[model samples]
Target: MASTKLYCFAQSGNAYKAALMLALTKSDWEPVFVDFFNGETRGDAYRATVNEMGEVPVLVEADEKLSQTGVILPYLAEQTGKFWPADAKARREVMRWIMFDNHKFTSYLATYRFLHAFAKSDPPVVAFLLARVKAAIAIVEKHLGTQPFIAGNEPTIADISMCGYLFYPKEEFGFDIAAENPNIAAWLDRIRALPGWVHPYELMPGHPLK
Candidate 1:
């Protein structure tokens, strides 16, 4: 049996963050598919047994059941000694970007994509989110131009966290993000070339939302 189990669905970018970390680190892990679209996450059984927060992307190892990609990514890095900087300063930089990702970058983009593709939220709401997403992407685009990765020269958990949602099809997002940002596109290409890289859709279960 795999030593780690990640409760996740294919379409969740947050889940992808943890899944990607496990993959890139070459951890002996397996996915426990979460039926997110069919209201599985919100169910009482899942809440009682898996996570009280009722969220996907929970990482299970022995007796530890850890939720939130912010926690999962760093835990995996610590355990595997991959995608984490050895330098104390660089580790702080990684945390900074990870916080930024959870707060601004991934938060805005994931919200916008969810409302646009799934919720079919009102245009005004979608536009509001899109504007913020663009703003966050602009910051990343500029930052990536100066360095090959988010935290520094080496690929770290920050890069994994930031690129969580970017790998999905443009149709789902209703726009081509890479086409507009050359720097981000190149950065993504670099990440793609890494060993054990896998697309989110193929990395987990519950694709097509049915």
Candidate 2:
């Protein structure tokens, strides 16, 4: 396997998805810290040299540079041949959950948490985001209630992608899925028991906030 480096900060669950996948796969990898809290991601130098999308968690391996947790997770799954669906239909199932995660689940929850906690935005805006977050979480909670994993019976890249932000502290979003959603909680426990599973804070830098 080629050497892998993930551009990430500890607070970024987006980066955490890629970082966690690398860890779970037991890949030879290292994290290049991105000072996201200081606006490094917004700088022109970083945009031009790194993601160009002003995003952290760019995965650099061999001669390829990949951005977006949705893409990076699948790429790593393919490379490692570890957390992938067994057939075409199953792969489509994985993609469905991954896309749902980006569009509805993690995206809404991340935005809500950022505005409500990190950015400390207005109450009106935070309330609006919170509605979306709750709706998305309900959908995920319902799905997890019936299935052991997001994609199917086994865990896949889809599970990793969707779970990117789910492991973060409940205070960030002001709710605890692990406590309120039994199935989701059980699934999280399973992921936690994986051989190399580690919390996002420990897997990357920039913890405890500055």
Candidate 3:
């Protein structure tokens, strides 16, 4: 197998999803940190190298590159034969949840968390964003009540993709994600207990997860 490299922003949850997959798979790869704040991703050199979209979490495998975090997670998992389900039906189910996360949950909740928690945006906008987040959480809470993981009993690419976004709001924004969804909380605990599980930001001393 050819060597792989992942270029990502250290603080981004989207980027962390890719890193988490690489770690979980025990894949040998190099992680290059892109300085998003300084427009490093937008530079010509970076644009030509991996993603023209100027996004972080670009996975480079030999001569090929992948840009989106959603795509990167399953690709890595499938390559490693670890988290991805083998059955076609089960894989489709997993894809359903992953697509839902990409089109629905992440679009609203992740954006809201990003704008409100980190950007320190307008209060009115934050309030509006919070409402959307609450609605999205309600839907997830309903689904999680029945399913052990997002798609089924075992963890899959869907869980990996959604986990970081789910974690960030609770950790940084003081959002009670677990309080609203008890089942989801249980699932989160299960994933946390998995072998080789590590926080992407573990380099930060005194991280709360410790």
lDDT of each: 0.93, 0.87, 0.76
Best by TM-score: 1
Off by over 4 Å in 2: none
Note the residue pairs that clash in candidate 2: none
After aligning candidate 3 to the native by TM-score, how far in Å is the CA of 50 from where it should be? Answer: 2.6
Tens-digit lDDT track for model 1 on 22-87? 888888999999888789889999999999999978999897889988888888888889999898
Error of 3 at 13 (Å): 1.0
Model 3 CA deviation exceeding 4 Å by range: 43-45, 169-171, 203-210
Which candidate do you rate higher for lDDT, 1 or 2?
1
Pairs with steric clashes in candidate 1: none
> Among these predicted structures, which one has the highest lDDT?
1
Query: In model 3, what lDDT does residue 132 have?
Result: 78
Model 3 lDDT vs. the true structure?
0.76
- TM-score of each model, in listed order: 0.96, 0.96, 0.88
lDDT of 2 by residue, 37-122 (tens): 88999999999999789997899988999999888888888888989976888899899889998898888877888887799979
- Estimate the TM-score for candidate 1: 0.96
Lowest lDDT 10-residue stretch of candidate 3: 201-210
